[model samples]
Target: MKKWLTIALFIFSSSVLFAQKSVKMHPVIDTAKAKWGKIKIVNGTAMTSSNDIVENINLSKDYSLLVTAIEDAGLTQTFKSKGPITFFAPTNQAFSKLPAGEMDTLLKPSHKYDLNYLITYHAIAGKLTVKDIQRKINANKGEATFRTIAGVILTAKIDVNRNIILIDENGGESVISNFDIQQSNGIMHIVSSVLVPKTKVL
Candidate 1:
């Protein structure tokens, strides 16, 4: 085990040196460094699935309502595109918790843009595993803020039970039920409630 760990450490060091040397040649890596500082080595399972975000969602029975919402909002293609998105997926039970008629109304073609905004509010630009979030929370003195794809902020904090809780812009709270479900494009964490943006809070 000691030998294996030493070998892993050597490989990690080599990779970091290579990344530093090639930063100038890779504009995307340079931009990432500029925004997020040094590369963070998050310990987790590798995401080697050939399935994209949409396909992964389709495989899950829990995401049926989310699938419908994606289809209704015409975001199927968008979610399938190449991305390292972090999606906070709410299950069918979460959608059922919404006020009656709200889902139906949002599904209407006239409310397509509104539905799109609501769904996209649950997504972040890059993959952030539970460990990454916990690290950010610890660094930020118990709370970490992340901007969603809809340009709204979501705050993450550790609850009394030590579960990661996401607080929407409108102060709605959703506990992460399951996390670090890896996909080809990114990762997904299942939430216990649908997060409503400040503008669309019911």
Candidate 2:
């Protein structure tokens, strides 16, 4: 009788432990995991996503600032459009590299057009993979230029290390930190810095 009682208690304790571990999940974490789906690793460094561009940005760990900027610019629907957009998404650290109070100034309601232009300047129409950009650079004699949706020019080149580097119209340089994050509507390449427009939008 005592042996049966001990076995029952052990089973109950194990079940209780399992239940406790199962309940130790946060809503935000769970939601992010659900939305991101499976992350496919390529070349043991790059990651491909299963969600759309906007959903990937919203669910990403490093794109919260970009998400907020998109919202502030009122370009959420623009990003969600059925497009083959090639977005140079800047990480939070990239946004932090801006001059003091610059992002704050851009985020103001009065500067919505400027913010929109700034964000759109990072996006080019059509889905361009890193290989595509590299081929363009080769075809253009080691430099290629693309016009963004905001009507700004972005130059691309392959560095000595073979990393794709983007030069904005203002001569700001941002290297692609991560490439080929595939989405349903397009692809995103993570950039190391914010690409400022040559002139503020009116």
Candidate 3:
């Protein structure tokens, strides 16, 4: 009888542990997982293979300039933090689309503050996936405003083509090219353009 009781307790404990492991902490992540179907696995060290944001960024060919700027700005430790940050990373082509010498100017030592603001404007504090963004847009009646670490607001909306567009304070628009690049500490989404925040959105 005691042996049967011990066996039952062990089964109950194992079942409880399994149930806990199966459940996620956030409903948004769960919904995003379902909506997106599967977590994408890439060949390079871009997203799934790497552990942190900087590694993924450094390994990506598209994000070469961005990674260099991040290092120059001295934000490597910040990116390496144990945060579930959501980063709207812009590609090299996006940086190229900037004003003729804007990229060069921002990289200068005197323009570090500007560069930091520019980069931080692309990041949010949480792991907000594509589905979370969609939900926010719907809840806000087609537009959602996200406050960034740079102390600015970025507006987001879904276009008619079902692509998500991020509108910076300066009115520059960036389309989300790749959605949900997961890292150990955060998530990164590739955007087609760089975002610049205005002093205020009028």
Stretches of candidate 2 off by over 4 Å are 1-38, 41-49, 200-202
- Model 2: how far is 171 from its true place, Å? 1.1
Name the lDDT value of residue 183 in candidate 3: 82
Backbone N/Cα/C clashes per model: 0, 0, 0
What digit string (tens of lDDT, one per residue) describes model 2 on residues 1-202? 9999999999999999988887785556667658765565422432436667787776656778899899999999888888979999998899999999999999999989989999999999999999999999999999999999998688999899998999988788999988888877788888999998788534
Q: Highest lDDT: which candidate?
A: 2
Alpha-carbon shift of residue 69 in model 2 (angstroms): 0.5
TM for every model, in the order presented, reads 0.74, 0.77, 0.76
All candidates' lDDT scores?
0.84, 0.86, 0.84
Question: Candidate 2: lDDT of 169?
Answer: 83
| RMSD of each predicted structure | 12.8, 7.7, 10.0
Better candidate by TM-score, 1 or 2 = 2
User: Which ranges of candidate 1 are over 4 A from the true structure?
Assistant: 1-48, 200-202
Candidate 1 lDDT over 1-202, as tens digits, reads 9999999999999999999988767778667656544332212322225667787667657678899999999889778878899999898899988899999999999999899999999999988999999999999999999999888889999999999999988788999987877766788888999999867554
Q: Rank the candidates by lDDT, best first.
A: 2, 1, 3
Please give, for residues 23-86, the per-residue lDDT of candidate 3 as tens digits. 7555577786665434554434325524688877776687889898898787889898998789
Which sections of candidate 3 miss by over 4 Å? 1-46, 199-202
In angstroms, what RMSD does candidate 1 have relative to the true structure? 12.8
